[model samples]
Target chain A: MSTNKIDPTKWVDKYSDYLFNYTIVRVNDREIANDLISETFLAGLKSMKNFKGEASERTWLISILKRKIIDHYRRINSKKGQAEVRIKYSDDSNEGDWLEEQAPDRLDMTAEDIMENEELGLAIIRCMENLPEKQAKIFKMKTIEGFDTEAICNEFNITPSNLWVIIHRARTTLAQCLEKNWF
Target chain B: MSKFKSIFVDCSKAGNCCDKAQYNEASLPEKVKMLVHLALCKPCRKYSNKNTKLTKLIKDCDLKTCTEEEKQAWKEKIKQEIALKDRG
Candidate 1:
C-alpha cells in the first residue's frame, strides 16, 4: 500500500481508465478531469496506508475526486451566487429549459448502448443534477453504480429508513425530471 | 369502506411486486394492516410501478468500459504521482 516505491509496474496497470472516466463524468471538463485524476492518485498514494480496502480502491479514488468537484462548485456558487442570481430549481415554470415529454420509448437500447449514448447519459445526468446533493450522490452510487444499500448507508452515515426516504425521493424526483424533460 | 380503513387496506408490505419492496419491506401481515390504504392510495401504486420502471431503466444504462489506451494512460499518470506524494 506504500506509495513510496514507484512501482510503475504495479501502478499503471491498475487504475488509469476508470479514474479518467470518473473525473470526466463528474467535472464534465476534460482538462480539469485530467488534473483531478492526477490529484486523486497522488493523494491515494500518500494515504495508501489508510487504504483498508474498505470500499475498494476505485471508490476511494472517486471519493477524493468528489471532494475536488465539491470544492470547485463551492467556489463557483460563491462567486456566481453574488454576480448572477442562480435560478432556483424549485421554480415551476420549466425554467426555460424547454423540457421534452416523457420518452415512453424505452425500447431497443442496451445498457451499454445507453451509457455510451451521450444524449441518453446526459439526460439521466440532468435529472440527477436536479436532486439535492446527498440524495443525488446516493442514487448515483447505489442505483447507477450498483452499490448496495449497506455501502450507501455506511458511506453517507444515514439511517436505514433515512436511506430509503432519500432514495425514494431521489427516484421520484428523477422520474419527474425525465417525464418533464426527456420522456 | 371507511377512509381510514381504506388507507389501511390499500397499504402493502414492501418488496411484493404487488406491494413493491422499495415502498416498504414489512411482512405480509404488516402489509395487510395497510391493505385498505393500499387499495385506495393511487400514489403508492403508481409509485411502486414507477420504482419498478426506474430500476429497469437504471440497470439498462450501466456505463460502458473505457478503451485500453485510456486505461494505460491513467495508470501511468496516477502511479507516478502517487510515488511523488509518498516521498513528501
Candidate 2:
C-alpha cells in the first residue's frame, strides 16, 4: 500500500516556491520557469490518479518537473536543426594560455556548487514543512520576504513580542532540523 | 549583586535578542544585555553561535519565494483545470 496521498488544492501554497526556485535555476528565465511550472501542475493533475502513495507529494511533483524540463530542452534543440560545437583560439601567439584564462574562475559557481546550493535550498524548505502552519508563514514573511516587524505584526494582528517568539521557535526548529544534514 | 541583575538576561531573553540581532532589529541596549548574558552563559553563547551560522546559511542559500499574485494565478489555473476535468 502507498503511504502518501495527493492533494491538488494545496500544491500551490505548499510547493510553488520550491518549484519556482528549482525551475528558475535550471531554465534561467522567469517566464519560462513559470510556464513550465504551470505546465507541471497541470500535468500532475492529469496524472493524479496514477500517483501511488509511495513518495511524498513534493517528491512526486519534482519527478514530473524534471521530465518537463528535459522536454523543454528537447524542443529547443529540435528547433535549432543540428548541434554545433564552437571553440575559440583568439590569440595564436599565446597558445594554450588563453584557453586556460577562458576557463571558469575559481570563484564562479561550479556544477558541484550549484547542485549543493539547490539541495540546500530544498532542504531548508523541507525543514519549514515541519513547522506549524502559522509559524512557517510568519517565518517566511519575516526571513525570506523581509517584511518589517511592525508590518508583519499588523498583518498577523500580533504584537512584536509574539512575532519574535514565533520567529525564535521557527529558527530553533529549522537549525535543529538542518544540523544533521547541512549544519 | 543588583548591578549584575540589571545586566543579566535569562537564556530565553538572550535568545530573543540574538534572533533580533540576526535581522539587525535588536536595540543597542538589548544587544548589550544579550552580550553580557553570553559572556557568562556557556549554553547561550553556543546557541548564539549556531544562530548566527544559521542566519548566514539562510542568506547564502539565496532562496526566493513567488509573489502572492503569482501564487494566486497558479491556484486559479489549477482550480480551472480541475473544474474542466469534472465537466469533461
Candidate 3:
C-alpha cells in the first residue's frame, strides 16, 4: 500500500472546483454546496490514514462528498415528518386529479426549442430548489442518478408506497411550478 | 368490449399511474390504465407529457457550477479552521 499523507492545503486547489460542481448539481444550492465541500474535505482529512491509494485522491474525496450529500438528505428527512403530511393533504382534494383550471396546458416546445432555451433549464432548477428538501433529493436520485425504486426505498428506509407518493408529489409540484414560471 | 375493461381507469388512478410509469415501477394493469387514460383524457395526457419533459430537462440540463473564486475562498476558510483546531 503506497501511503502518502495527502496534503490538506493542496486539496482546495486541486479538487475544489470538481467537488463544488459535483455537489452544486446535486443540491442545486451554491451555499449548501460550499458547506458540503468543506465538510467533505474535513471528513477526508480525518480519515486520511485509511487511504490505500486504490483510488486517486480526487476519487476518494468525491466518495466522501457523495456520502455527505446522502447524509444531508437523511438529516433533512428526519427533522420533519411534514413530508408525509404534505403528500396526504395535497392529494385529498379531488382524489388527486387536476382541476380544470389547474390542469397543465400543452408545453408546445419542440426538442429544438427546449435545447436552445437556457431559461427553461434555469426555470427547472429554480423549481427544483422550491421542492421540499427530501423531495428534491429523492427526485434527483431517481431522475438524475437513475436510481431504481428498491435502491431508493432501501436508502430512505421508506416503503414502496411512500416512495411513489413522494415522487408523485414532487413531480406534481414541479409541473405546477414550471407552468407558473416557464410557460 | 373485454379489452376496454382491461384498459379502463379513472382520472385519479391515472395520476398515480403516470408517476409509476415515469419510474418504471408501474404494474401491468397500472401501465394499461395510464395508456387508456392518456388516450382518452387530454388533460392527463398533457400532464404526462409535461412530466416526462420536465424529467428530461432536469436530467439533461447543464447545471451551473461554483466559480473559481468561491471555491478558493471556501478552501482557505476550511484550511483556517483546520489550523485553529490544530493549535487548540
Best by lDDT: 2
What TM-score, to 2 decimal places, does chain A of model 1 have? Answer: 0.39
Please give, for residues A1-183, the per-residue lDDT of candidate 2 as tens digits. Answer: 988978999999889988998998899998899999999999999999989988899999999999999999999989886767677788787666757787778687778987898889888998998899899999999999999999999999999999999999999999999999887
Report the CAPRI category for model 3: incorrect
Write candidate 3's Cα lDDT for A27-116 as tens digits.
878888888888898888778778988777877898999899999999987978666533232456656554655667658856676455
* Winning candidate number (TM-score): 2
Native-contact fraction for each model? 0.27, 0.73, 0.49
Q: What is the C-alpha lDDT profile of model 1 across B5-78, one tens digit per residue?
A: 44344232332333225433455665565444456677766766676666656554454333446556767776
- Per model, state how many residue pairs clash: 28, 1, 0
Candidate 1, position A167, lDDT = 72
User: How does chain B score by TM in each prediction?
Assistant: 0.38, 0.92, 0.60
All candidates' TM-scores?
A: 0.42, 0.88, 0.48
Spell out the clash pairs found in candidate 3.
none
**Error at B10, model 1, angstroms:** 7.8
Off by over 4 Å in 3: A1-119, A181-183, B1-6, B62-88
